[model samples]
Target: MSNIKEDQANFTNGFYLETHKRWEKFSNWIHCICVVTFDLELGQALESIYPPHVTLTKQETLNICYLAFPDSNSGCMGDTNFIVRLQSCPSKAVLSNVHTAYNSKCPPALQINPAYYWGYVYFRQVKDIKLPRGYFQKSVVILSRLPFNNLFTKIISVIAPEYFDNGNLSLEAACYNIDQWPTPVPGLTLSLPLLGSVFQTFIPHQRNSTSLILQLAGLNEVATSSENQIQASVEDLNLFDIFQPVLSHIDMLWELVITAEPLIVMASSPNHCSLMVLALTRIISPLKFCADHRTYFTIHDSDFKQFTNKVHGTPPVILGVTNPFFAKTLHHWPHTVRLGEDYGQYQKYKLKKNGNSKIFDSTPGVYSSYKPFLQKDKTMIKNLISGINTKRPFEVQSALLKKHLLELTHSFMIPLERYIASLMPLLKNISPFRAAPTPLPFNPDDFFAMLETAGPQLTTGIKGDWVGLYKKFFRSPNFNGWFNNRYTELALKLQALQLQALSDADLKLWVQGKPEVEIVDMVLKIKNKIKKCEQHDIPVSHTIKEQLEQRLQDIISSLPDDLKNILQTS
Candidate 1:
């Protein structure tokens, strides 16, 4: 029995060692294939297989090999130009026959166990091929997989929320690939997410959030710069005075995802490694600290939380009136208080003053002089008056008022913060609101209507003004004056239309008066204008037309129920 137990132990140990050895061999094989393959097939195949104990069928293995070593795009494999030549007594016919047989038997794709495969293949056409050993070696390193096992898999599951519940197939395959190449490649960082990691995690979702964050950060940076410039220019001509409607452009990125959950999942996934890196870089970047104080201070969540805490603790108290005698005493005392004499003098003075006051009238004239003596202090006065009028303690009234004021302030702040945050990305497109030459409230609808009526005449007028200004100041050529004027005029007009469409009253009125019918008529008019413009070879901008169409849509969206019903009819 003892001998049998010992044998059993020996057998188990040997089996474990052999398994390890097999995995090592497989890793080597995969590395070699990666080096030899010209295409992404092998890597993709490895990615498709689940990890750990993953075993590909014979067919699957062949398919993987074929994909890895595609004959097309020889440049990817190596820069060596080579020609194939058959030597020996074998007839051309015989060589052709052999080649055909080899090709027929070869699988469309090839797969090999990353752990056990160690063989290498050399591609030789009938000619001399010049291959770089270093390049081949680098490719091999890239293709090799990292060592992953059950233990590693468990660790990954715990660390990466996306992969926790998934099966071990992907992990096993990744481990096998890792075993193929034990050494890391130069210039290749380990931080890159493996293909398996991408599959298991929602990377795509995180990408969107990261993009938005980056965009916001960029806008904030621009706004900060502009604000700084404005501050610096304050001593000079009011920065706002010389400001013009700078033509600004904003790039709006739109993605149509079916659901929000997937977006959230992607944002939360491990695949957002790039986003994490970006966030870290931004946090550590020295330039971020140099930004405007408000912007720099606002970016941090902790600072806002601290401010809120401080404001919450201290409540604002109002100052008011109490007793006439005490008030007089408080007012007359020359920075010092005397007890009996001063107090009596103060009372007499208060009685004379109280004769004319309504508050003293409430009490009998004789006792009015004996009015309650309360020390005159802003807070004390406020408290006494509030208590007398409200019939409540000063502290309670102040606390309640402070709480209400804070709430109102907070209500205003939340939306402002959100808007400011949103504006960060759009800062580049928004011209600074100038205070010096008070900015004219540019009505978009009115502007567009004028443009439609005036066309190039209005554009020319703007250009003439700019040209006159340019000649007066710099005496320099204004080559772009005409183009800039035309574009600006058109843009302002379109802006006006967009603003009008956003008006709730106009939308409601339009909808009630048969918006659908109006829309159809408008579409027809636009189509005809577009056709005529094309026919006449007129340089009408399509962008203006598109904006007009969008305004129609906005109007439709904002239509009231009664108007909507009218539109629905017929």
Candidate 2:
């Protein structure tokens, strides 16, 4: 116990020289870097700082420490990496995909405006006999608003172990190399650099890899990013990786994730726990589940009360929790998936529903609530099985599963995407003679009619009474958000055209036979339209503003003596 007290006070700072890279550049890639280590005699302590001179506030240091050492028990299997998000005050760092992840009914945690934020950590432990404990525990943490999952993980892999053996000098060199990297843009393959090694990754387009709803409507509302890139991809996010633990019920799980049901994924380790959660979230790519989810949650996480206590609030719609304690604690959660390590049972999982622990305690087997609505591709499953038996490279198997899932997702979105486009008012329909047209009101019945007629052709690979799924999604925040954006975009287009025709071709001619008061009203109306344009970030037409101003002046000069005095005073 005295040694434990001694361990508690043990901490070491790394030594390094400053790099030539600009300070602000370092910040854009990552907010700050932290290194934490555990002395067997002690618990966890902050060991070093990357930008060595600065000191952290108590709040910041405590937050990092909490996230740094998340595991409740002692178990180290080589090295593991995972992600954590800290509850923070609203910051300026909002990522486009993170924004899209929030559906209108998003949990209060996500709805809070605290912008993009996260902590990507790499934990490693090495045996040390000279200490109070047999092993020395250490972890490297990066605090950043960016969710460059692969990129950050790669950065840690290069820096952490080397810093462990060497010191701050090695860490500084790695940071310098990273500082030279370019800003992330969606849809382009970026060649990232770190310590003389380069890694290439293609940032998936948000439209292709994340929810369809990409923009937020309403000015002074949560702003949406124009970049097409969704969040950074994890190395493994395909069905093979996510559902590998329960391949038999792959289709059913897909339905569950798409519907954004409350789910708990149990795993043996924090890294596996976090990876599974990230993969599940992305597997329903391009559909955007829009539910609040934590990649990895420990029993000690700050939100424990919010999750377990129904009196305060309900739990997140989706969660990935570690620690067997959750077995009893969250037994009441709607769905729980307990995982096994060996590849054999990776396909088998404990799935509990309706708060039934008997079901929870029951032996692992296929737990299908009902047959999947989407037609299953038996051939694909056989190939996956064959690949596993033949021991095919994991990448090849994961790729095949990914392609199939994307095909299914695209199939689901196509008819709806096509139908949504049809609702836009025709360009020819715009006229100064009338007010801007409203988007054709969405009629689910009409869409269903079209599906009945052409659904088979549009979704050749997937056949089902997905009408239920689609209807369920209609009540979700994602669908509402998508429709709202489409409506706003189309409405703005209609107004733009009307403004164009009125400024160059309609105003002068339409006012020819109108009264002075009516002309004044017309000018005021166009002015209001310009204001809306500015609010939505649509380019305002100077031609219209100038023409309307000229018209207003003409009316004022021509007004009768009595009316002129009244107008001037008003």
Best by lDDT: 2
lDDT of 2 at 381: 78
What TM-scores do the predictions have? Answer: 0.16, 0.73
lDDT of 2 by residue, 1-570 (tens): 232223222211222334323544555456678998875454677888765554666555666676676566526556878887665544343533323333223321123233435778888776879766777678898876655556677678777877777666566666555555665554455665655556555444443333222211011112233343222232334446556767656666677777666677766666666766776766666555566677777665666767887565444366766666776777666566666655233455544344454344634333334445676777777788888889887666776776666677667777887788788788788876568787798999988888876664565665667888788768766577557766776777777777666555544456676897886676557656667766654444776667655654555556677776765465
Which stretches of model 2 miss by more than 4 angstroms? 1-22, 39-63, 91-116, 130-134, 206-238, 311-316, 343-355, 358-375, 390-393, 426-429, 432-443, 461-464, 495-570
Error of 2 at 79 (Å): 2.3
Each prediction's RMSD over C-alphas, in Å, is: 33.3, 9.3
Clash count in backbone of candidate 1: 49
Give a tens-digit lDDT track for model 1, residues 1-570.
233244334434443465646555443313212222333333323323322244544533443343232233222333221111111121211312222332222211111112222111222222224543333311111122221111122223322232222323333333433443332221111221222332111111112322322222222212233211211110011111111010000000000010000000001111121122122112211111111111001111222343223334411110111223322322221111111211111121112222334322333111122212111123433443444455664334333333322232233223322322222222223321111111133333443344344433332221222222212212211113222333444444433333233321233344455656665554344444445444433333666556544545555455567764554352
Error of 1 at 184 (Å): 15
User: Which 10 consecutive residues of model 1 have the lowest summed lDDT?
Assistant: 247-256
lDDT of each: 0.26, 0.61
Which whole-number lDDT from 0 to 100 does residue 14 have in model 2? 20
